[model samples]
Target: MYKLCHQQQVDNACGFYAGHHMLVIAGSKNIRKPEDIVLSTGPLDDWALAGLRESLAKFIMSEVISSKGEFHHPTATY
Candidate 1:
């Protein structure tokens, strides 16, 4: 999907769900079923595709830390 998104050049991604004997596509905002996905040209890379996944992962980590009562990085947790 990242490669597809980069090739097509778009953002606003949708998660892919594989199926048998066919290919189905969908967008982030609209989903009916795994096989009932709407066709799309997405991934919303903002032209920074290479870093998107890592950046999102870091963002999620930050959110998790915030939920755990640690909103900022500690100077020394060793």
Candidate 2:
């Protein structure tokens, strides 16, 4: 089992490779309106980016509950 650590031993084991890593973001887009925004994945894997899109899906496109607690159908546009 792999337990996530809080870098307790990081300071003690600081090595040359520690400063060699770099973070990169693939691509980004600015939406004209927050509500008109739709996120799509590129040919890459990023945990942070993927999780962010999934979390925001509900807010971007969601159905409202009526008096009967039934979901409303969202009309699609061409």
Candidate 3:
């Protein structure tokens, strides 16, 4: 997962990677407030959140295919 996200240069790769691949949904209990005022607008709106969900689903599908031992590095295509 780290390799996958690192290849894409994603920030907070660990959490985002897990979110993309995990079958069971995970939530954070830490709930720290955002330091940036831009984030103070609250959670993402429905449309934006839906787009994220779609991306996660696509990632999971790709992982499932790669897990069949078809690719040496599953993230190589990215």
Cα-based lDDT at residue 74, candidate 3 = 54
Distance from true position, residue 12, model 3, in Å?
Answer: 21
lDDT of 3 by residue, 1-78 (tens): 112212333455435434433422233234353221122123334575466678866766665545654333656564
Model 2 poorest ten-residue lDDT run: 16-25
Indicate whether candidate 1 or candidate 3 has the larger lDDT.
Answer: 3
Q: What digit string (tens of lDDT, one per residue) describes model 2 on residues 1-78?
A: 333222323442233112211121122245354444333222223464455556445534454333232355445331
* lDDT (10s digit) by residue, model 1, range 28-58: 3365455444444443334543344565567
lDDT against the true structure, per candidate, is 0.40, 0.34, 0.43
Q: Which parts of model 2 are misplaced by more than 4 Å?
A: 1-45, 63-78
> Candidate 3, which segments miss by more than 4 Å at Cα?
1-40, 66-78
lDDT of 3: 0.43
Is 1 or 3 the stronger prediction by TM-score?
Answer: 3
